[model samples]
Target: MSTSRMPLALRALRTLLWILAVFGAVGLALGLVGLAVMTEEEVVRETGVGRSASMAALLPGFALVLVEAYLAATLIRGGRARRWCVRVLAVLTLLSGLLGLLFLDVAGLFEVAVAVLLLALHESRSAREWYRSGTETGKPDGAVPAPTG
Candidate 1:
């Protein structure tokens, strides 16, 4: 928790989390819509067969979206728990992306794009150094140890 790094790191984490949350919201919305189509007789009657099937297939994407949002929020808090959430979200994102592509869902492509951008932000040079050195390991480069006094 270096004083200087705290502000910047928190800001970066917040931005990344918010971005993931937005994507998750979209997925959740889509999932709810799909569920409606799957269960409602009126929806089927109105939209017909193909659209209903398409909606049904989108359920998993929506579910994954909620999970991603939770993980992103956890990431901001920064703990062992948060780290685990990140891993889960990463895997779910990959799985959903694959499913979306296979089913020709455009939302899957959108998820892929956002996930890539967030990953780039998280893996930026500064972020990595902060993660590796700031937490529990080496001191910042060029930092001199204090005199024994």
Candidate 2:
């Protein structure tokens, strides 16, 4: 079975993922700029670390942004790899969100909500079917059908 059109939920999820990708990219660029403009003294004072250590401390954030960008690309392209990536991302998001909530951080709670939504989207029947079939064929289930006479 195939869908003639992308389900509304899937479309919305894809759009959200793309938006997240853009957000991550912007954050990464801003972070790089901030790091570049900060004085060594300021970095040391803020992080209580030497210049090199402070730069190294930024690695996790950079990695997260890179993962977000990759997730967006995989989601947009749609394949077996996307299924695994989404699962991993969802788990990471959930763990981060839970940790945030434990520390009484509002942002963590928000992240938790987003993680739940992402999980829901991924586990939806349509999404599951689509992934199963689409990955096998290396084409989305919602591909436009060729018109027949």
Candidate 3:
């Protein structure tokens, strides 16, 4: 995109994304371990389902980890795809936070805060301009220069 230096806010967002990704990774690992160690009866008791159904419960956590990792990499590389990914992540985070609140999980409130911050940054004029700067037009700033004689 614009070969120019990345904005400070974007840099900060990237760092935050990396941190979130790491957290997701750890959560995923722990979830997998818990699943592995759970006895069939324990799984049924906890989920009110069979072993297969209990294992399916971890899929969402795995997906979250994958999405976080992809977002971090895209942000790091300054990929054109990052804009869309950030938007998706922000919405997903907000939804997750809402769900958490509904379930009375305190941690969901924190995710909601993070989602708000991300949405604010992404919607800012600077971030919009940055995302717009790099596009299929192949011109920096997407401006058509005046033709010279």
Name the best candidate (by lDDT).
3
* Best model number under TM-score: 3
- Alpha-carbon lDDT, every model: 0.58, 0.71, 0.75
- Candidate 1 lDDT tens digits, 91-118: 5666667789899998788757655655
**lDDT tens string, model 2, 1-149?**
43334445656666667776677678767766777789988877777877677667667767776776666655645666777887787788889889999999999987888788888887788777666665332246556656779
Tell me the lDDT of model 3 at 31.
Answer: 67
Q: Tell me the TM-score of each prediction against the true structure.
A: 0.54, 0.74, 0.78
**What's the CA error at residue 116 for candidate 2, in Å?**
1.1
Instruction: Give candidate 1 regions above 4 Å deviation.
Output: 6-13, 26-39, 44-77, 134-149
In the predicted model 3, the residue pairs found to clash are none
- In candidate 1, residue 14 scores what lDDT? 51
- Per-residue lDDT for 56-105 in model 3, tens only? 87788778768877776566345557788898989999999999999999
Q: Judging by TM-score, tell me the better candidate of 1 and 2.
A: 2
Q: List the candidate 3 regions with Cα displacement exceeding 4 Å.
A: 76-80, 135-149
Against the true structure, what is every candidate's RMSD? Answer: 7.6, 3.8, 5.9
